[model samples]
Target: MQTRSKTSSLLSAKAAAAASPATTPRPPLKPKPFLQLNKHATTPLPIQEMNWRMERLTPPPPAAAVAKVALARNSPDAPKVEASPLERRRPAAATVRSKQELPKNPPVNWEYVYDEIKLFRRMNSAPVDTLGCGILASPTLPPKVFRFQTFTALLLSSQTKDPANAAAIERLKTQLPGGLTIESVLEVDVKTLQSLLRGVSFHMKKAVYLKGAAQILVDQFDSDVPKEANEILKLPGIGPKMAHLAMQFCWGINDSGIGVDTHFHRIANKLGWVHTKEYDHEATRKELQQWLPVKYWAEINPLFVGFGQVHCTADHPLCHKCPVSDMCPKKDFKPRK
Candidate 1:
């Protein structure tokens, strides 16, 4: 019984020990590894672009730097614009140049001749338009194939409308019985020229002029028209104005003729280029010759003639639309009421 009882106690103690919770030792807890960034990380944006650059360029205090840039963009006290190297160079040249060479309204006076040339800007601008455009309207009036032929064309042009001149020219083209040149005119007699140019302005008188002019061209200058302005002026009926205009319009000589037609004289007197008691075309031409650059002198005739015919005229002028009106010398000029 004692042995059984002892066995029973041993079994009970074993059962009890087995039933009690057994504590297993946990593995030693290791500290977590520290976080490490890449070799060279940067902000998502670049530091050199405009916004970034401005920000980075700010002085020690970043807030103050931003404030400076803001003040700079908005400041009324800032200079108008950065001066160019050419602007810096101009004063030296201006001081050296003679006053006669420089116009008073230098900024707005490029197209004007010496002091006489005036660019009349348009007023009452609906949008934009010009009188200068009328001057350019007759580009096709004088045909290019026969540049020398322009002399004859000009003869046809006097007192005749452009279309009339064109019609006369077209008719003459068919009747090239003579070649419409001095040599050609010399080939045919005065009667033939008069007949061919019958409908053109002053046909009979022009034929006489043609015959006279042609003989001079043949005897003195050979068959060719003279290119030099002075040499051409010597031809009969070819005055300085005509000679210069012919050289320029016919042969593309830029500097020469004083283009003083009735229109030019009228416009000029109106513009105050020459104050003359006579207001004569010839006198005005001579007067302008002194002031305008030899280069720009010849162009004035065509320009004024064109301007007069189309825009400013003997009748009602479209002054509100005149291109050079702001600086016009005409007595009629007044601010539109």
Candidate 2:
């Protein structure tokens, strides 16, 4: 009985131990090795590695230093760099010149001319707008009448003075059956026309031309003055100067071509705007157009014509009293006492 009781107690103890939770076993702690405090032997790193480290640490050089380096590279003492053939062949930037530096014609003092024109406009009151050229003067007349009258006046004014041309135009206007209309001019006999135009220059020849011009207008252009400058040139006795003037006065066409007369040519030459040896009107016209701006086309003819009449005459120009005397170069001038 004692042995059985001890065996039962041992079994109960095993069951209790098996039912309780099991804990993991702890790891063994490692022991640290001993160290000695000794002085380290000083030694340099590889040259490349040391250089790389120094470069990484150093700051960049300044802009002035970089520019000096570039300039030194291009200096004569520096080694020459051979350029490629193509690079050597390439053109450099072209040097452009101003018009003033390379002038085509004798350079005009345009500022002085403009100032002189303004002064002439103020000082001289010679009825340039109203009575200088009778053709340009009578714009108030009827369109057809204006055209015919202007043409007739230009024809009569070839070598005639202003007052005499005015008188001739007046006589023809009153004496003609119906007036200076194309029909009236055509109706008047050549003999009667010559009588009426007796005061003007080239009266006899102009009388015949008047009839021919009237006939041409009647046959072609429906008795109306042509708008085209070329068409006006087709009519007998209508030259470039007359045609351009007529177009400006009658149809208000300007700036296409300038009217170059003796007075205009003289004034332009005298002002040194044109440099032509020959006294050719057409050549002077082209030269003036090349140099002078387009705006001066219309005003130049009338202004110079009026000025030529009063101050800058063909025979004896009044240079002392002239407005542009100080500025003008005064080519081929002969002063009058």
Candidate 3:
């Protein structure tokens, strides 16, 4: 009975101990750190070893993602969206383009040019004088002048600008029918001369001068325009420049006397060919004559003049689409509203 009681007491004690609250012990675990991705990487993820315990605890992904995987596994004909072309992508470090190189024409000073060509101005300009001067200088002079017709052109050019210049010469050929000769011009009186020169500037003065010039040509130069620059310069009202122009365009004088004009000097200085203090029509003529080769000599006046007249003027130049804009050294000339 005592042994039985003792055993029964031990069993009751064990049962009571089981029913009571008790402490539970746990194992120690180490914490791990994560990794960071860089800007160059297309996809960023930390590399990890998936333990069975951790993987089993995680839930499955969405059904749509699962469907995508299944489709990739099954059908090879699905629409393939290609990424960017390999050549188009850079290696994340190269800053400049590798293929296309820039043009390296001599730099023009565009700042002053822009300022001069701006719309607003304080100076008063006569339209006829300004535009007429440009027109006179605009025509491209041929390198070699060889014919009487050429000399005739120079003779007819007094006080006449473009369309009128061309018209007067053509009309004289028809009306007088002596091919711009001194005799033919002398035959036409003041009235006829005025009528012929009606479209030109200062017709009265020009008519008198034209008659005198023609008479002088007949009496002095033997109906042939003087080929010598000195002789042409000595004639009435024919200055160094006019002589130079006539010699260049009528008698083929190439290596001497660059006929400088307002357009030439204006455009050159504006483009920073020379300082304003050091620049003038004569100086610009000398500098450009030195710098620009003879091959481009004939082209300079016409191109710059036409461009000056139309796009780049004393006021208001259209510089936005200029071909040489990229090559300009000083490009900080912003157009005003």
What lDDT score belongs to each candidate, Candidate 1 first?
Answer: 0.54, 0.68, 0.50
Instruction: Residues 78-123, candidate 3: write the lDDT tens digits.
Output: 6654423321221111111111122122213232233332311111
RMSD of 3: 29.9
TM-score of each: 0.53, 0.65, 0.50
Q: Runs in model 2 with CA error above 4 Å? A: 1-106, 127-129, 134-138, 277-279, 335-337
Q: Best by TM-score, which number? A: 2
Single out the weakest 10-residue window by summed lDDT for candidate 2: 90-99
Whose lDDT is higher: candidate 1's or candidate 3's? 1
State, as a TM-score between 0 and 1, how close model 3 is to the true structure: 0.50
The digit string of per-residue lDDT tens for model 2 on 1-337 reads 9999999999999999899876765878875432211121123446785576455434334435544544555688976655434223221111111212333453534554555565454345443444555344366777888888888887777667777888888887788887778898888888988889887878998899889999999999888888888998888877788787777777788876788777778777676666655568888888778867777777778877767766678887777656566446673376565
